[model samples]
Target: MKILHASAEYFPYIKMGGLADMLASLTKEQSKTEEVYVALPLIGKLGKSPHWTGKEFPALLPQDDKIDSLVVSVLKASRFLEAEESGLKLYFFQSDLFQTLDSIYGHKEEHFRFAMFSYACYALSQILKVDVFHAHDWHTALSLALQKDSALPIPTVFTIHNLAYQGDHPFWMTGFLKEEPFRLITSPFDHDGKCNYMKAGILSANQITTVSPGYREETLSEPNGFGLSYCLRQRTLDYSGILNGIDTEEWNPKIDKRIFQTYSFLDWKEGKLKNKRELFQEMGRPSLPLDAPLVGLIGRLTYQKGFPTFLQTFTERRHLPHRYVVLGSGDPEMEDAFFQLSETLPEVFYFYKGYNESLAHKIEAASDFFLMPSLFEPCGLNQMYSHTYGSIPIVSRVGGLRDTVEESNLLKFKTGIVFEPNDTSSLGYALERAKDLFQSQEREIVVKNIMNLDWSWKKRKLEYDLVYTKAIELKI
Candidate 1:
């Protein structure tokens, strides 16, 4: 089947969060079975790369008479040998819309920028004559809107990576939509008297999917749904969940050259120790006993990640004997708080101000446990990476964290631990248990169990292939 996947950003080109990782891995995996192509904005920051096949397609602009229409150039990129070997086509749209160094969202003309992208996606699909258009998040949500108005006979599948980030803007922002081409399209994009781009996609698409089974359930409720619960419930028959998978080849600690040491599931202890020592030296922590438990966290320093709960657990429950190394940047207040905690407890806590991909790998390999106490995680990739590196994950019991990390992985012979979301006391208790396990000889067994968990894309890819087949069958 010929599939066109559309997103705002993609890996090796641009990455903001797990969405990029998911798209890159899914495309590479699905390419083995079907013809997969991608459409993304050609942001100037990605600069120029050899992977893109620079070509242009037609785009219509209603207002400007002299240049009422222009050619939207595409930069086809597929750097991964596996994608090329499997015959996947990765296409990027090079337009002035993504040229600015400004943030992806919260721009003055974001409504028009994303709308243009969505319209361009529909145009590209028609030009390429694709069988199905698979779009991610609200950035490409308007593509379904374009398809609804057009006479195009293509089917669409929309994936909601995060329901919280619905593209809701004032309707008046889209002044150009008053023209002939956009007049026939119903304004279902307006939800609660506002332009809800995500709602429009969810309402219009033939199929809708989220990242994890737990998240699928959460999004159907009041708290986690972000006001789209009722809408999602109405489309229950059309919606489903598929857990996100990791690219084991890229994340495997055994072969990863980014970390200080390399080790597999069988011989993880030695490499883990090497990593821990390196982490201590790099973070400027004094040399401590190898038996000391090291808990690592890598994420945005935001309230959504349960940073406050983490701080409370670490500060109030001083009885627990453990060290924490945090790497992230967000919300200046939270960053400063973490920095202060590191200063107050120099021996037990370490903080890295910003994100560094290689350092993330090092932290995963070096730490005895990975902590992701998110209030609601759509589907965390770091926890999966932690399991692969033999670093047991201690996460809040919510969303994908609940689905991926099980009790067996957290028990005496288990790989990881889970606590109730936003419960500081529970988090502290879980940490104590993990620390106690480490002090005992049971830590090795736990690490071994975690290392044995399968996080490969092979199985998830099969599921995606099935989804693609079902999408095509429904289209037929």
Candidate 2:
């Protein structure tokens, strides 16, 4: 079987978050039995990769000979330096429109950048030999909608990595669809004078799936739905949720070169102390007590991850003994909060602005507990990565965080701590629990349990295979 996986950013080349890592890992696993090709927008320099074969072709986006179209470069090759990378081909879309963008996101002309990339995906799909098409997030959601509107017989699967980012734009921008008679082609994209790319994918794709089973159900529920709950609810029969897996090679504590030292669960106690001591020295806090629990929080400092709660809790409960080491940069307000806290109390707080790949690895390896109080997570990889490194996660009971991490409340052999609500108190309570547990013998057992669980791509690949088969069956 031939399958095409289209995403905006893939790992090793460029990655903003979990989407790139998840897609890169899945495509590699899927390549074993099927003919898989990954298509991405080449926003970098044209000559950055000599590994790719120049497959630049002149093709009209909609396959219409009368319309004026742009000639784009399509680099076909395998991803560089991936050990398990099978015979999968990487299709990079190189065009002036996409290359000139300030970044992958947050540009003045964000809509047009993705619109052109989506059109380029349509052109590439028509040229490639694909039996099934899989599009990730709102970035490639338009690709599924375009193929569906053209009455393309090929089955398409649209995966929602996050429902929050819908690629919304002014409805007037969709004037190109004025003459289109198909409501399925136009109505889904129309959201009260707005173009909702994700809604279009939900309404048009053969099947829709989210990153986690719990998130799939939440998307059908209230606030978590992010305004497209009704559209997702309508397509209940075709939608599903599969928990995403982490790239074990990147997160493995035994072999990760980024960490201060490599160690497994057997030696986790000593391993953690050594790394924690190293971390304290590196952060310029050599005198900080190693006995006090270190709670590491990483990822974008946004409201989505309950960023405000952490700051508020730290402010109100300044007497709490545990140390907070935060490694991430997002939202100007949140950044200020972290910086202010560190300045006010250098011993209790340590903040680092911007992403440091090596520091992230070290934090997971060293910290006593990993804090990720996300308001709504599709499926977080950090929690999974923390579990692998023997760093218990203190996550809110929502979406994949609820699905993957079992709490001490109901289960006996639980993995991590879980709080019910998204407020400051709830997050504070969970952290308190994590701090107390560190003094108990049960903490060792929980870390062991978390590491024992399998989060490999091989296991998740089978579930995707089932979904792909179901999509093909629906097409028939």
Model 2, span 1-476: residue lDDT tens: 88988888787665777898899888877777888887777665332353645455432443354443221222122111111234678776666656665357666766656665665566566677578889888888877777786656568899999898998888776544333222235664787568888888888788889999999999997798888899999889989899999878888998999988899889988889999999999999999998988999999887888878767777777677889899998899899989998898898999999987789999999898998878888899999998999988888888999998887565778888888656888777877787789889998898888877788888788888888888888963
Off by over 4 Å in 1: 47-50, 59-87, 178-180, 184-186, 286-289, 408-413
Which lDDT tens digits does candidate 1 get at residues 372-391?
98999988899999999988
Per-candidate TM equals 0.91, 0.92
Clash pairs, candidate 1, are 409-415, 409-416, 410-416
Candidate 2: clashing residue pairs, number: 0
What lDDT score belongs to each candidate, Candidate 1 first?
0.78, 0.78
Q: How far is candidate 2 from the true structure (C-alpha RMSD, Å)?
A: 3.6
